[model samples]
Every structure is written in structure tokens, then in C-alpha cells.
Target: MINWHRLFGLALEDYFTGTRYAVEMEKDVARKRQVLDVVIVRGTGEALVDPCDGLEDLRPHNLLTYKSGQESLDAWAIEELIGHYVNYRKAFAPREPAARFGLYAVTTRRPRALAEQVTLTPVKPGVYRLPVVGRSITLIVLREVEPCPRNALWEIFSFEAAKVAAGAGMYQWRQDDHFPILEEIYRRYREAGIPMSYTFQDFRRDLARETLPELTPEERLRGLPPEDRLRGLPPEDLVRGLRTEGRLRGLSDEDVAQLKDLLERGTSRRQ
Candidate 1:
């Protein structure tokens, strides 16, 4: 089985790279093996260049609980998230105001059980505000989020094949090294018998195509051999912008003679 929780945590870490937030997975809130799913704490960096869908209002400390498509986001999950928050607050910053912390529950599917019990006020398309114990919790339904570049990270975890494919195409990883995580995600989806039309090879080629335009000509041709650099060009195209002397400079005597004869034959045919 795929470790969805760990993968999601790693993806969050990748998404928040270069931002002022540091993402910690399975954080120990207390000494008795009680761990929180994810914790985003204040760190050193600039703000996010493109904020995610439900994380626009990040506080100094953010606690997130995630439920995969197979998992149930029932009342116990909410209680667990709150329990982690309370313990984290007491252990780290007991005197800090509650406003300094943010609580979030991210699920791949709608939490019908929880919604039936408490009111989930719709804040936006996929975002909801849940009032519990005098604090508002942000409930983000991944599958329902707007399908755009900014929400691609959330869409990848939505468990819908189409959304996952779209998300992979739209997401631009902050760090190039994080590509392995994407590959692993693809492998997991295949392992779980999910029929994804977007293959890993397709994602790789598309990613290369998207980023290649940002490179300079020299950078693009950096590791190419001389033959490979001119592999597909026709003889005419190869010599198009060059003067006669420049074109013949690198040609062997036999090659030059062959080119001259070929040109003469072509000219005779045209005449």
C-alpha cells in the first residue's frame, strides 16, 4: 500500500520551499508517541510567490490533519487535530495568543460524517470554515478546489485521476530535486490500480518543454556533441546564414568537392 500521508507531507515541504514557512511531518506534540500529521512553523524566507488555495491565511504556527480518499474524516479526526493543537501550544508557546496558530483539516473527499454533525460554512468553492470550541478551522476539500496552477498541489492529492493528471501538468516544483517525489506519486497511483492517462514519461517531457524556454542558447546546447547540434538540419539550412568561405572553412577537401558537385547538379536541373 502507498504511504499517502508521508507523500503528502513531502509534497507540502516541496511546495513551501523558499517560503517563510517550514513544514515538519509527523511532529511529536507530546512525549507519549503522539504525533501531528504536519506542522508549518515560521521560518526565514520571503513570502510565497503564489499562495495555495486554502493556505492564504497562514499564521505563525499551522497545524494540518490530512485524510486520504480511503480514510474517513469523522469527528475523531477533528478532535485529534484539536488535541494536537492544544498540546503543541502548551509545550511550545503557552502564553502566545490563539490568533498566532492556525488549524486546518485537508481531506481528499468531503467529510460527510463531520459535516452532518457540525455546520461547515462555505467560504469558497472548496474551502469551508468550521467553528469548533470557539475557534474556526479551515476545511479544505481537495477534489473540489478550483483547477488552476495555484491549486495544483492540492489537486494532486485529490485521488481523482483526471485532477491528478492536470495537477502534475500544472505544478512547477520550486526545487528540481523534488521531481523524485512526483515520480513516486505516479508509481503509487499505478500500484493502487488507478487508471491515470498521464504517464510519468509524459510528465517528464512536458516539464522539460515548459522549462527549456527559460534557458539561454548556450545553456540549451551545453552537453550536445557537434554532430548532434546539427543533426536534423538540411545542407542548405546548415549554410544559410554563413558566407561561402565560412561554410567551407570546416569542410574536408573531398567534402567540399562533393558539395560543389551536388550544387552544380542541382543548378543544372533547375536551369
Candidate 2:
């Protein structure tokens, strides 16, 4: 079952934070404060789902949900739902140009009181900030009545400042609000073109730029052919170089198998 509450927060979070940094800064000199807005704009993790294709499954009685087949709806599905509600509630919980989104629903599914003991206070309707995390994070608690196509949800928009004050190292991150599952979902959503998340092998493949090992006669005898230990200078040198090169190059599966076969046959042929 989809948690409409979690989904609501997620829909907006993924749009702003899940993508790369979206921010601009301004100083509140009078209050001796600095403010930043991570605005939503075209970037890597962006999409354009029409207000129509998004909300076919919402219903009023349900407080938090997106049922079976509909749950298959991916990240953009959630964002689209949020967008729909924002448009629907234009008169009520209208979008905040400063933050550029909206949300409205019971607070049951809101993020658990951040274990960090942080609390958010609405400076006014629809704007919230906490005393923790350098007070850089903020939630725009949306409060308006509107029809959302994702019937199971009441929408909410989230805006957070990623930039921390000078020297506030750890205080500036966009806290996940303890939702790794949704974090991954949006990760996949942002990478919609790719069907799968990156794996260790994928990482190795992507970073295939390491330095190659040095080749030497004794090293070849130690690594590839113990029997070739007694070979002459150039003979030993060539064998060692090729074996070290193979290892350094990150041999493919077929290459390794063929290598073992050649090794089993012995290095006499290479000589």
C-alpha cells in the first residue's frame, strides 16, 4: 500500500532535492540571517507529466494510499499527483513562488519527529523551519482543500535550503526524513531512462581509469608462470609484461577463461 502522507512529502522532495542542487541565496541583513531557496527547474531528474494522466486513482475516503496496479506508478507519478493538487488548489493552498509548490492533508504521515530532535514551526501558513540542521531545512506545510487524482493522498510540498552558513559543514544536507525506500524510488525515477540502479560491477566499469601495474621478470614468474622463472632476460621480461598488463587492464570473463587455458598449456608457447 502506498502511504499517501509519505508519498505526498516524497513527491515534492524528489522534484527539488532528488535532482541536483537547485538554489539561490539572499541575506536577511535586518534579522542577521541568510536564506536560500532551492528552486525547481529543468535539470537531470526532471519530467513533464500532464495533470490528466496522473490522478485517475485518488478517492476521498482514503487518507493515505495508492493501491496495487496504481502503486506501480513510479516517482514521476507521485510528482504528477502533487502537481495536480497544486493546480487544483490554486485558490486555497496556492503555490508559494518562493518555494514553488503546495500541499494539504492531515499530518499523520508527516515525517516522524526527526530523531535529531528537530521541530518545525510555521512562520506563517504553509511555511515551516526548524532550529536544527542549521535551520537550513524547511517544510511548506500545505493546508487547502482540493481534489487530488491520487485519491488516496492529500498533497504537501517541501522546500529546503541546501546551502549552509559559512563553516556549518554537516548542517546543510537535505535530510531524507528517514525514507530510504522512497529515496531509492526517486533515485530510479530521476534515472528513468535507465532500467536499473547502478551495481558494484557498474561502478568498476564506470571508473576504469586506474594505473596499470609495473611489469618485471620475477614478478611474471610469481604471477603467471612459475616454470618460466629460469627464462632469459627478454623472454622473462615479455612474459611478465603481458601478464601484468592483462591483470591491470581488468580482464573480461572470456579473457580470463582463455588466459587460464593458456596458462594450463604453459608459457612455453609465448616464449
Candidate 3:
């Protein structure tokens, strides 16, 4: 088996740029960008940042959306990160050099706002890489930790590294303490020759739903309004009420034009 300890250290080394034997840096060091607790906009050759400024600003508005799930940090961290960048404004702007945020997470969810701007690909369970502009970021999921663990509160995803561009923390989540349980669940699945990426959140979801409910097509449509529904309606829904019941079976003029444009140019990459 590979040496997990050495590998862990190596990963950290890569994360911290190149830490020699892993002694924490007290202040920002130019070359050792690997171990920064946070990366602030520079001032007099130093670092200082407002953590709450980013994601916290967006929480009250629907600009930031989140849902509860099995893992604590996994359930919340990505949302918080989204809030952070949403707060950054220029962080994911239309024109910026490629840059990335180092992360530690217990789980991940689809980002709330920047989904269209960044191209995200899964690097590992609980880990992802988001390519924003030309720069790339490494994300890690974590769980909730508390002095009051019994209440099961799930908030809290920030860390020292978040203060810089490379914050990582040992965040606790719902199934974080149940490592043995997860290993066993995965082991049983694999032993039976079923392959799956088993995570703590996956185990918790299984534990929570004794019988999962199924959603049907009509049931799915119930939440959608005629305006929001994608039924090829056109004329900007102004003509919907007048003889528009099943009259507009085809796509809107805009949709057809968009399709034509796609066909003409095809999918091209940025230079």
C-alpha cells in the first residue's frame, strides 16, 4: 500500500507551494505561496482580508442559494465559497487572468451563481477544480465542527486559509466522525462487485431515507410557471393568453436563431 502519511505531507507541500517539513508560516512569504492562511489584496508587502465580505453579503438575497444534505461541510462549504466570490465582484469578472482558490471541503454542491462562468470538473469526491478565466482553483469539502456537537448545527465552513487564497481546514460534517461506517459501506459494495464513489454524505442520505420518493413528469412540471417553463413559447409570452394554448408548439424565434448560430460557429475554445 502507498504511504498515506508521506502522501498527505506531499499533497500539503504541493498546496503550500513547497513547505520544508511543514512548519507554519506566520506572515505572507513570496515563494511559499503554498501555505498561506489567506491571500489578501496586497498592502505594503502584507496580507489582510475580510472573510465575511464575500459570501455573507449574498446570503440574504436569492443570488446565493443552498440546500441541506448529508454532510455538514460538504453541504455548506461550496455555497459559502460562492458567496465569497459573489462578494468579490471582480473575482470572476468577464476579463481576468486565470486564478484559483485552494480549498478544503467535506463535500461539494453545484455553485449557485458562477456556474456559467467557470468550468468545473470533479477531481475527486469532496474535491473539485474550478477553472475561472485562465486560472484554476482547487476546492476541498469539509464538515461541521462545534463545541456543541449534540445540537447538530451545520454552519461554519471558513478557515485561516480562506483569509488567503489557500485556506484549508479539518471541517467536520454529518458523517465526518463515522469514517469506519463509510469504509464498511464502501467495502460491502465493492465486495459485491458494485463500483461506486461512496462518501460520508452518500451514507448519510442512505441512512436518512428509509423509502425515497419518486418524482413523475407531471409532478416535476407542477413547480414551473408558464413563463418559466421551456415549452417553445415565443413572442415573449405576451401572446400566450390569446389562442396560445398549444398554438406555440415550436421554439421561440430567439431559440431558433440561437440554434442557427450554434450550427454556424460550432463550439469554439477561448484563446
Best by lDDT: 1
lDDT of 3 by residue, 26-100 (tens): 222334231222322211321212221111111111111122132233423454545444443343233532232
Sorted by lDDT, highest first, which candidate order results?
1, 3, 2
After superposing candidate 3 on the true structure, give the runs of residues whose Cα lies further than 4 Å from its correct spot: 1-26, 29-110, 143-271
Models sorted by TM-score, best on top: 1, 3, 2
Give the candidate number with the greatest TM-score.
1
CA displacement after TM-score superposition, residue 95 of candidate 3 (Å): 27
Worst 10 residues of 3 by lDDT: 54-63
Question: 1-271 in candidate 1: lDDT tens per residue?
Answer: 4388999999999999889999999999997989889999987899987677789999999999999887988899999999999999999989989999999999999999889999999988899999999999999999888899999999898888999999999887877687778888988888878888998889999887987999999989999999999999999998899887997898899998899899999999999
**Clash count for each candidate, listed in order shown:** 0, 9, 30
The local distance difference test score of model 3 is 0.34
- List residue ranges in candidate 2 displaced over 4 A: 13-124, 144-271
Backbone clashes (count) for model 1: 0
For each candidate, give its TM-score against the true structure.
0.82, 0.19, 0.21
The lDDT for every candidate, in the order shown, is 0.91, 0.33, 0.34
lDDT of 2 by residue, 1-271 (tens): 4333334434434333553323221211123332211122234543323221122222221111132111332333334334433333353234434233322222222333332344556544433443321212233232221323321122312111111111111111244452453344334333433233433243234333221245354543466564555456665554574666654486688988898888977877766
> What does candidate 2 score on TM?
0.19
Clashing pairs in 2: 22-38, 55-149, 58-150, 58-151, 59-151, 103-142, 103-155, 103-156, 104-155
lDDT of 2 at 187: 43
